[model samples]
Target chain A: MSSLEKRLAAEKRFKFYGMFAMTLSLFFVLILMYKIFSTGSGAFVRTTINADVYFDPNFIEVSSNSSKKEIMKASYVDLADQVINQNHPGLDEENFIKVREMYTRKFDYQLRDYIVNNPNVIGKTVNLDISASSDLDQIVKGNYPRNVPEAQRKINDYQLSILDSLDSKGKMSKTFNFWFFTNGDSRDPETAGILGALMGSFYALLICFSFAFPIGLLASVYLEEFVKPGKITDIIEVNINNLAAVPSIVYGLLGLGMLIGVFGMPYQVPLVGGLVLGFMTLPTIIIASRASLRGVPPSIREGALAVGATKMQTVFHHVIPLSLPGTLTGTIIGMAQALGETAPLLLVGMVAFVMEIPGGAFDPATGLPSQIYLWSESAERGFLEKTSAGIMLLLSFLIIMNTVAVLVRRKLEVKW
Target chain B: MVDQNSNYALQTSEVYVHYGKKMAINNVALNFPKNEVTSLIGPSGCGKSTFLRCLNRMNDVIDICNVKGKFLLNGNVDIYSPDIQVETLREKVGMVFQKPNPFPKTIYDNVAYGPKIHGIASSQNELDEIVKDSLHRAGLYEEVKDRMDDIATGLSGGQQQRLCIARAIAIRPEIILMDEPCSALDPIATAKIEDLINELKENYTIIIVTHSMSQASRVSSKTAFFHLGNLVEYGETGKIFTKPDKEQTNDYITGRFG
Candidate 1:
């Protein structure tokens, strides 16, 4: 063959190799997306219990006739007991008490209201479908091994029997979980939700936004637009690039030492979490912002100057508006990365076993990743599924945020 | 053809430019005519484009660039004076770069950017008129009028260059500087730009830097030749092309050696 034919063969081989590489990369990305969705979807559906239990009129009538509001509150537990007894007539005293415990611990006042409002229907059956305990729910959902030794299981044979009965009767089904929204961290995996972590994350993000946005933007402007490119500026640029690659967990360690240990700020609080994440995300924000600012051509600056615009005016009016989309996309991506980070939160005190929803940023709490960590370590057999579910929730948030970034970039992308 | 209006639109005396410790342009003194085209011709690395950029003080944008000596405009104001703002000087002497450097924006936005930044137009309608008129002057309006909102980058290379020229003209500058405007253009586009330069000279004083001696002869009223950062000759374009002032200038125009 001629040399030209050999060159043509080589060119064809190169094209084939390029196509193969692209296909391989796309395949891996698709597999990753599939795995994340498959593992995480189960966390959104929760098993609930549906049953009809009689409400006794005798307990309700006494509370209704009482003048004092305090006496009316005493009937709450009595109503719960009546419902349990009416549902499981053949069960022994201990078994009945265990069944009664399945109702929400916060539903006492709600039970009392139901009894007082419906005295006529107290003896009659009232159909109620309530959230099952996480362990029992896990058993019904086949999360717990059916063949496990009775002694090894957290749920006893009796509770399993009750769950089995409920399942056979088609009274146990997965429902949209309200507890995932309203509840907080519990020693019980069934009671765990992201409310505490979500609040903490929000507070941390607020702090990050306040600190990172202005500082990062200003630093980027100075580096890209204002400062003369020289030895000192080159050094600063190199340091910023290195900072972006620094381990986020190191920032957590730093925050733990400085913000909490040295500065004497409250531990397990969002303020410190925010400060750490801010430090972790600052380099990313600054790097992205500078890149976006540089993306604006020198011609725009020259054009503005040629029209008698001051440096400040050109930057604020033309450069900022053109770069705003890229800046926002960077910020969202940074926040999303911060959202899924567990190492830094672990270094800080976000791993506390918080049982109640945090009221504010300063309120001590565990975040979703930390909660997942907490659940995975529990001795309870049911917490494994809850851990999986928690991971799912965290991953979904990241997906949504990244999707928004992609959309913003596509919508506002400017080409020169 | 030195008109009465041929007072110094721009003047440079003993001007020197250094990049770090290395001298780029040395002791250059020249005058640009009002309402006429002055073309600077030289081989590569001869500081022709550097001399053009000096009129608008664009060298200030480079960190290592340092300038000394007098750069005056309108025979009175020294543009290099401490009190003179680079922004104000650039406003009077608008520039078009070698490669068309239109912003990553709509053609309308690209043209209106100058006027909008300077607040030359009070409203959107006025800004629109200014953009239209400038495009018309740049000889680009009829070709691009239907798609002014399309991204400037979408245009052909020639169209993009003309859009940049329109962008510079929109500022109502007294002097226009072209830095190898036709270097990246096709022969047809170069011809169009040459025609536009001739038309522009009727309203604004124009200075251009070109490596093409034929281009310099065809477009310019006055010509200056530079060799190794030194002004070798300056005279009427006709006399410089037809006759001879210096052996070097003659040899250069005749294609003996750059």
Candidate 2:
């Protein structure tokens, strides 16, 4: 072949290689997105079994005038058993207990809440929708493998038949699972929600941003604008750059040893988690802030100084304001990265199963990633969907944060 | 110490500037007469701009630049003295840069920045008056009067340069140092700036650094020639153009060599 033809062939091959690599990466991303969506979409809806529940006076020991606390202390298990027996009459004790197991453990709490809220409904036959158990929910959602033998499957033939009968009668249906967004973590997967984890992450990020943004900005400004370049400053610069590359788990270890051990901060609290994340995020923000500050043209500084502005005034008035949009973009990108981090949170005691929504940064809580991590380790079939759902939530948050960063840059960026 | 009775507006004695180990400005002593336009002409890298920066201590902003010698403002005040506040020195000696480096702010703010920082205008009305007067002096008031709130950078290059000049004059400095202010402008803009400089000589001591020999003769009464970091010639513009005292100055002006 001619030399020119050979060169053209080599160039074509190089272009093909680049295209292949791009396509390969895009393929993996598409597959990952599809898998997460497919598995997680079920968590947004749950199965409910509607029944005529008699608020039987024989089982309910509280009167209409009874306080909520007194009503809550009544025998709810008997009430639930009596209601389940009424729904499935002619069942023996064993079958009656099995039928009662079809409902969620928190179904009793739902009944109790209903009676507590509406005292006029006492002894009345009320039509109520009860949450089905996670096993029944999986069956209704077609997530459970029915092809497997009854011995190995989560639901047996008898239970499946009963679920099918309920479905045929229009008593069992799938509805939007508001509790998935409202409730906290629970041993029962059907009742678990992300509100606690969401609040935990919110408080942690709030504290993280408060601590990292100003400290990083000031540190970068002092280093980039104020400090003269010398041996000491060169060393400090190298160390700060190195800090950005350090493993975040090391920062978690530091938080555990210094913040929790030495400082006596409570374990599994968002405060310590946020402080650890802040330390992990500081170098990122500092490096980004310094880059943006350096991007400010020297002409602007000279203009301010030539106009008799002090060095501080020159930086604050002209240099800093011009670099602010870029600095904030970097800060938000760093915060987004911190939001998805899980390993460091594990070391900082944010891996605990927190059931209550965090009231403040100091309250014990688990962040979204830690909650997802905990759910992924569970043995239940229902937690599989919840794990993917939690991951989806975390990714959406990252996307939203990065979008805000881009929008802020577009809005506030100065052309010059 | 303040010296009000001196005939010269600024005088430098044996001023030497070094960028690290390399010397940029040699021993150069020159006096700028009060209320006159004096132009420094030199080829590229000849230290004319460096010497101009030394007058206002603008060289202090460079981390590696070292300037030594006596910079006496109005014959007696030592500009480089440790007791002197740099801000006050800069306020007294305003500068317009080579490029039209107006702040990315409104036209009014660009003109008002110097006076605002120096606290010269006591009220909003006073600041507005100073901004108007400075813009009028820079010959930009007629073109930009209707758009005072618009960003200064949005204007044409010539207008931006004029806005920078207005910004400098708003502080009402005694000496105005312009370093190649017309280099980035077109011929028409250059003519307008030259005319503005001619009108400004009655009120301010103007020291301009230019590469154009014709510009030096057009705007300045006195001209100084710098060659390779050394002041080679200092005379009237007519003498410097027609009959230079130094052979190198003659060679540079006559298009023989830089």
Candidate 3:
């Protein structure tokens, strides 16, 4: 072959290599997305059982004249047990317990709440929807293997038969799991929701951005525009870049030693977590901000300075505005990275199993990644799906953040 | 030292520029006469632009650049005195860069920035009138009158250069220093800039640095030739082009060598 032919063949080979690499990466991403979606999709729907619960006064031990406090304090477990035994008569104690385990443990509390909220329902039959146990829910959703031996299966033959009967009668159904989005963490995965972790992550990011952005911007401006390049400035620049690459968990240790240990701040709160993550994210914002500030063409600075503007005026009026889009893009990416960070948060006490939704940044809370870590550590079959679902939520937030970064860069970047 | 002439608007003596020990401009004393266009002509890297930036202390922006000089404006004010504010000096001596460096702002804002910052205009109407008059003086108002709010970067290269000139003039400086203001333009645009310079010298003392010797002859009344960071020749434009006394100036003007 001629030399030209060899060159063309080499070009073709390079193109093919690039295409293969891109396709391989894309294939991996698709597999990951498919795995997450398939497993987590089950967590978005919950299995519920409908029952005609008769509010018997004898079982409730509450008369029509009974006070609301008396009704609330009444033995609701007995009433629920009676209702289950009435549907399946002549059951031994073991079978009875198995049947009772099909519904959520909190059904008694739910029944008491219902009666206290509605006093006129006494002595009348009311149709109600009850939450199923996590094991029964996994079975109902077909996520659990049914062909396994009776000893191996979580739902045994008898319980399966009862569930099949309920299914046949259309009393057992799958509904949108609105509770999964609204409730906080729970030992029972069926009742678990992301609202607590989501809020914790939100507050942490809010605090992180509010703390890091202005300080990072000002530091970068001072270093990039005002300070002369010398031994100290050079040392500072090198250390700032080095901090960006340091293990984030080290920042957590620093936060633990200083913010919690020395300052005596509360632990497991997003405020502390946010402050820790802010320390982790500060170097990133400063490096990115300085880079963008450097990218602002020197001619623009000269233009402003030539107009008899002061150095501060030139920077604030021209340099900062021109670099803002890049600075913000960098800041958001840093926040996204902080959102997915777990080890630093784990050290900062954001890994605590918080069950109530955090009302404020100072409240005890766990971020989404730590929540996923907690759920993934559970030995329950139900938590497997919950883990994937939590991952999905976290990944979606990352995607949204990255998309905003790109949009901001495209929208605000001056073409000149 | 050059002769002390009261007719000169600006005078600099014993000016030396060092960039961290490497000399860029040697001791070159030159005086710019009042209301006349002077062109500093040199090849690339001859420090013509560096000398031009020294008049307003624009070189102070470079950390390693050390400029030692004595500059007198209007034969009285010591421009380099420790008490003098650099911003105030820049207000008196404005500059246009080699590139058309307009701010990424509206045409009106680009022109109004200098006046606004210097507090030359007290009211909106006064700033508007200043902007309009500057643009008209720069020969851009007629073409861009309807699009004053449009971003200045959207204009053509020549128009952007003109807008920069207008921005420099809006503060009503007595002297305008232009560093190769037409090097980035085509022939037609360069011609337009040369025409604008001729008209501007009636009010502002215009000192331009140009590489094109023909541009020096066409636009300037006096010319200074810098070679290897040294002032090789300085004389009237007519003498410099027709009968230069220095053999080096004659050789350079006759295209013998840079």
Runs off by more than 4 Å, candidate 3: A1-5, A53-96, A108-126, B1-5
Q: What digit string (tens of lDDT, one per residue) describes model 2 on residues B57-122? A: 898999899999888888778999999999999999999999999999999999999999889999
How many Å off is the CA of B94 in candidate 3?
A: 0.5
What's the fnat for candidate 2, on a 0 to 1 scale?
0.72
lDDT of 1: 0.81
> For each candidate, what is the lDDT?
0.81, 0.91, 0.92
lDDT per residue as tens, model 2, A35-121: 999999889998999999999888888878898889888767778888888888899877766777789988778888899899888
Ten contiguous residues with the weakest lDDT in model 2 chain B? B1-10
Error of 1 at B244 (Å): 2.2
Q: Give one digit per residue, the lDDT tens place, for model 1 in A1-416.
A: 99999999999999999999999999998887676556545556676677676666575545344544544556456666666676667878788767865654544544665555654454567787656666666666666777888887757787777877867888877787665666777665555666877777777778777888778888888888888788999899899889888888899899999998899998898778878888888888888998899888787777666566788988987798788788879988998888888888888898988876777778887777788888789876556656767777787888999999999998998866
TM-score, each model? Answer: 0.86, 0.96, 0.93
lDDT of 1 by residue, B1-258 (tens): 222233879877788888899888888988897898999998899988888878898887777888887877888888989999888788789999888878777899989988876788999999999999999999999999999999888998899989989999999999999999999999999999999999999999999999889999999999999988889999999999989689999999999988
Each candidate's interface RMSD (Å, one decimal) is: 2.0, 0.8, 0.6
Error of 1 at A17 (Å): 12
Error of 1 at B240 (Å): 1.1
Q: What digit string (tens of lDDT, one per residue) describes model 3 on residues A274-356?
A: 98899999999999899999999999999999989999999999999999999999999999999999988899899988999
Q: Ten residues in a row with the worst lDDT in model 3 chain B?
A: B1-10
CA shift at B166, candidate 2, in angstroms? 1.3
Docking class of 2: medium
Q: What ordering of candidates by TM-score runs from best to worst?
A: 2, 3, 1
| Global Cα lDDT for candidate 3 | 0.92
